[model samples]
Target chain A: MKTTIHLKLYAGLQKYASASDDNHPIETGDSVREVLNRLGVPPDKPLLVFINGNRSKATSLLQGEELVKVFPPMRGG
Target chain B: MNSFIGKMLNVDLTSGKIETVSIPTEWAEKYTGQKGLGTRILMEDLDPKTDPLSPQNKIVMTSSIMAGTIVSCSAKLAIATKSPQTGTITDGSIGGHAGAELKYAGYDAICISGKAEELSYLYLDPDKAEIRSAAELKGVGTFETEIRIKEMAGDPQVKVLANGPAGENQVLFSCISTERYRQLGRGGIGAVMGSKNLKAVAIRGWLDVHVPDMKECLKVAKELHAADKIDDAEYEIYTDGTPILVDFSQESGLLPTDNFQEGTFEGFEKINSASMKEVRAAKKACFSCAIACGNYLKGSKSDVEGPEYETIALCGSSIRNDSRDRIIEINSICDDVGLDTISAGAVIAYMMEMTEKGLHDFGIRFGETEKAVEMVRKIAFKEGVGAEGAMGTKKLADKYGGAEFAMHVKGMEIPGYDPRGSWAMGLAYVSAPRGGCHMSAYPIEAEAWGDLDPYTYEGKADLVVGLQNSQFAKFSMGVCDFWPVASDNLAKLYSVTYGGKWTAEEVDIIGERIFNLQRIFNIMAGFDGGDDKLPGRFHQENLKSGPPKDISMPEEAFMKSMQEYYRLRGWDDKGKPTLEKLKALGVEDRFVQQYETYLATS
Candidate 1:
């Protein structure tokens, strides 16, 4: 079974986002890092991942999460 | 002078005496250039608390040693003075040919002192430098000034850094617009120019900068430029310029609306990136910039170089002017008249909100662009309501009854970032040496797009402090922040350019010293715990509606970060640098004496 969650990828990861039109469908108990891997983001590139507008570690569970946002390294003022 | 030029053109406007002075190599080793070196000059020379408009107040225009190098984004000019707005050590960067041109003219800096007996403009070349009367050029718009001056001087290639009617009128928030489109657009640097009775600064370079190691410089430049092209897949900046941030700000719950009453604008799509591209005439680049994030949009209102994110958010969203065309028109008018768009939008929004609240009615309403548009002209000429508007939001709030929502820090109006949505950003706003500045420490990306928790209480200080130090270091080295120049590479490039051994660790240390000195300049000017604070709105109010709702600046979480930032900065509890910290950073004893004296006097 799969649970759906809102997902947004920005900066460098913006182009890799192909999870339907918007919210991503992921395994119910997928870890944050697992979701990133499933999305095909480069493993070595620095990223800031969020679960439901909150900073989430790679080990965090997504079972209860409803939103995810991933971002790539960006520098500007 | 070596490759650094190590010489400055010191022009005393009153005495009409221009002299060449040699800068000590020791100064370069310590402060780097621009941000650090410029601030060190101010701290050592002027009373940090000197009234900004006074003749006694000095302003320095310094370029980085790499400014004229083949390196991309190396053409930025740093201008520093006691600000009429922030009343602290205030500086901003102007991009385009000015810095590069000035550097090529055999001087690293053009430091202007003493007010002129008559309005004047400076012209410099490799052989001759003169202060010429600008009487006929008074009240001219910045763009026309550049064009007309070039015609008058018969040199189209000469770069002109001029203020608009606003600067000539001495509007407190007026900014210096250079390269026609780019600006040193914060803390009323233009007002300082006006106070000096100087109208415009024009320059042409006939000499080439001596690159000590061209091969190494080219290798690094090629790699950096290549990396920049692919740095971000979105490539929004390269494609759409900063207008790309409009939709991102709206979507991410960070768009400032109704003078920051809300975090989202309803008219986001109308002013987003795609719309800007439609009107974009051509892409623009700074002097030697490869990424060329600047834009040139052809609008029915007037062809403009911007309506960048700040203009869209401040004038369009916050002030309720939803039409992209209208925003572009206002942007053109502001540029033409020489107003800082951020402060102008902020001031107009404050007036609109005040009139709505019946606290004060300036015959303005939100979403009504006509009065505001008309006021843009008046503000530059100091005409009528524009006179009040020229004072910017802080003073307007002080007179009217809306200090609560004035949206400033340390008397400088804050930018487009909604602090409640990003805690670290809020900390950056309050603790910015120049007040409410986002650039020195842009950890907002961490919360907005990256790893830091936007709403969390912990590690914010660490993030802001780290970014601040790194950024100051970057400014010192005169590297453009937008370029894909890594710290390691920056140190390497600097080492090669200056023939000095600079390790990445040294970069961090030098950056810290520069950062600490800027803070010490503020502290010397009598800024205490009181100046390091957010506007009344952020502290007491939450966004009424947005994706990031119920978010007010959590005082405890944010304050903890501020304290941590102070600690990391090696400052005492009162936000003053400790003696030990000063010693470590090599802040001179004379600076300490001045700091203590001003601290006592103020």
Candidate 2:
């Protein structure tokens, strides 16, 4: 069965895709790494991934209906 | 003498004496400059147990060896004093032209002691230093005080550091405002100034700072700027300033909502970077800074330099008030009245919780935006309940019986980061020489924002120690925290400015030494392992939302981490630095022997 996730990109990472793509199709067992690969994130670029507002490893499997967020490595304050 | 002016100004208000003293070469070599040098000066000038508000207390203002140079972000001014709020050795870094101007004025530092006979301001130019009456400018807001001082000096370029009504009232959390925007923002430095009847200081100078190699300095500065242009973190800072943290904090369950009852704010979208960008008026920067991180905003009813991330977190999410415009207005009032926004928000939020719980009736409720603004004003003017509120969260909680939820580590209020989500941040806050300061060591960068697991206590102690050491050294060197220079680069900068062959290892040692020096001063002031603790609420209560939902800082784990942190720093279980560690850091023999005897007897 197919599933979809809400994807958000921030801090100059939106150039790769729209800032918020409310419904992005994914497989039931697709990993964050797979999603990033499909989204055209450069393989060597470092990113902070979050699934449902929790810090997630890129290789962690994602469930459908998750709010997946990606950000460029950023720090201030 | 390459970058330092090699002259120090000693101002004794009681005697009306102003003397130019040569800075000791030994002190310069040992402490470097800025916070480190200022800390050393304070150590020698005032007894640690002296009342912070009394005339015996001294305020040491020092510039780094790099100030007044073409170095990027090298214009920070360090102000060190015993904090009236925390009674700890506290030093704040003020950014603007003040430090650079002082260097240009042929002085590396100013040590101000003794109470003035009356209200006064200091005026310093190339060859003149005078204590002038500020009785006419009494009770003026910091913004107007700056304007009036400039008029008095007849130079628009004159940099002014002034305190407002909050300061004049001796508010425990009052801040010293500079350039009418930046601040010596924490630990009640302004209160000390007010206690001394010092309302403001105006400085102007045009002399060229001597550099060992002007050519090399320019090349290094250009390279640093070029690198900053392409860096993603710097770009985010340059573009979004600090409100970008709102997005990350909200996402990571670390936005500090409702007095840290919860870590995430549902109304975060109303005050996040996107919301702030809507009202963006302009961007500003400190002198010689490449990263222009200051966001000047024009809200619907108010205009201000920022409601920076800390202000937004404390005044917006933490208070449950999400109106961006009101936050900006609150920021303006705090800046104008010379109040520390972090502590002000902490006070208001604590009172809100107190009132809600029926512990005490502060007449303020959660998300009462208008009431919150009024409280800020009242706190500044010492009106109504704000008179008590100006005493800060710790004392309020003490009297009102809410010590469990006071949100202060020492007597000083906690900063924006809620520690339950990032355990190491708790360690950093508790172990900070000053109280609950985020700038002491930002472990959240590694945890909430980076790759480290935010939930675990493992390895946090080492991370906190490393960051603290590096940050302390950088502050001493007068480098801006935002620059993120590596040890090698920092060593190179030092070598160029101080005319020496400095190594990265040596630079790291300087950081360690500065950290130890502050710790020693605090220990001497009577702070110990007992004082290195978090508010009970963090341990007893769980955040109710986001990823950190149902999570509390485990008391056992936290204590373990604290002990580990002390061990890593070569401090005893009681959190006093060991004699061997002090000696290794090249601390003077007197301090080493004093600690040696204390440790032996204890």
Candidate 3:
């Protein structure tokens, strides 16, 4: 069974991958961390990854068809 | 004198008399001037039961020993009094030229008490102090009043701290605006100022804030200036301003939306930092600060200094209004009307939710925000529903019946953080002396995204307690909250500016002592461990949308952490400072004996 997840990079993280290149798709058995690693986001930069509107992690396993979003950390106010 | 003016003015508005008094050296050494010393004065002089809006309530304005010095982020003025909203020891921090100017004018602090017979303003020059008739300035907006007073004083550099129309009407959330942008923006200090019938305090100075070692002070300052630029990569507060947090918090599930019913707003993209970056016309900073995280925006609504992260959360996302331009305009209006944007937004959102729940409507809907802008003026003037809403969230909830989800702690509205998303902030909010404030201890950097896990209570108690102590100590020195300065750095700066080897450990102890002192003040004023809890909505209900869906604070974990935090503070399980704890913190038993007495009675 072939299944895939769509990845959208936002804000400062867009420097890695943006809509100009369009979102890349990852299949089942691939985790969010795998996608971030491919995009060159450092593990220590406090980046937040959300899978289909839920707080996910770099190590979170994708369940295919999930919309994975990534961005820099939030602070203040 | 090494930055110690050692003098304060006591103005009794009712008698129209002003007296200058010497600030004892021992008191200055123990409390470090600004927030710490101001709290000590309030604890000693004020009756805990005094009505915050009454003549008995006193407003003490002081600067830290660092003010007017070359130290980075050193110019801040601390305003302390019983909050009309929280009924607790509230200290509002104002950043701008005013704090340093007040110091340069040869006074370390100004204590204003009693209600005046008529409207007036305090005029302070380097050599003279007078209470002048401000008949023409009555009921004017803060911006115009500051400008008028500056022109009247004939000094373009005169620093004017003025209350706006909202303060005149005594709005519980009224703020004191300074330099047209910086504000003592929380805990209703302006209402206390207005109640005294004092319109503004304009200061001009011709002296310098002498430091013990100017060479070493400038050297440390240069290092801080260089270090602040390093934070630009992770926080980027300088480049994009605060709106940058919008998208990140939304995705991370911390952004409060629709009166905190949800953790994310779908309308986020339209009003996030990218939009603020596009509209930011200029960058601004307060006093001699280097981080420079401030911005002035020219959006479709108006040209103003930011709808910061909090305003963006409350006005932009909380009510489902995603128009960045409108939010910017609303921020400007809020400034002019003297309303703290956090409370203003929260109260309006409460009314909007009330309308949703079949309560009385002021024609407010989830996504409709234009009406609230009009109500901003009405709130200042005390007109229409603004009369009820200006009373703030707790009062509005009392009138309308939403006690469970009023979203306030001790009458102050909660800021942008949805505690469900950043669990440590829940503890911070509960433990804060001035009710629901995020500035007290922002633990999200560590607990939410840094080393510690955000889900469990494992290290959160230690994290929050430590942050609170450090922050309290930092603010005691009138250090601006925007920059990141380690405790060691603070101690070195203290030693260089003041005299002596003020160790980092001593600074920590001073912070802890100040925290306990404020707690003792609250204890006498009737706060207990019982007050250290969040709104029922946060504990019982769950966030309905986004990454933090249906997640609520775990009861047992929260309780465990709270208890541990108590132990760290040397407090009992009920959050009262034990007599032994007071002794260890160097708080004289006589100072806290009243609180101990209050505990015995209850």
Quick one: best DockQ, which candidate? Answer: 2
Tell me the whole-model lDDT of each prediction, alpha carbons only: 0.79, 0.87, 0.82
Q: Kindly report which residue pairs in candidate 3 clash with one another.
A: A33-A58, A54-B547, A55-B547
Candidate 2 chain B, which ten residues in sequence have the lowest lDDT sum? B227-236
Per-residue lDDT of model 3, residues B308-391, tens digit only: 899999987888888887888788888887899999988888888888888767668788878878777778788988888889
Order the candidates by lDDT, highest first — what do you get? 2, 3, 1
Q: How well does chain B match by TM-score in each candidate?
A: 0.97, 0.98, 0.97
Q: What is the TM-score of each candidate against the true structure?
A: 0.91, 0.96, 0.92
DockQ comparisons of all candidates to the true complex: 0.26, 0.49, 0.36
Model 1: residue B484 alpha-carbon error in angstroms:
4.7
Report the number of clashing residue pairs per model: 1, 0, 3
Candidate 1 per-residue lDDT, tens place, B222-305, comes to 776676563343555665667767756675678888888888888887887677878887877887877677788888768788
Give candidate 2 misplaced runs (Cα > 4 Å).
A1-5, A15-18, A23-43, A59-65, B224-234, B594-602
Displacement of residue B351 (Cα, Å) in model 2 is: 0.5
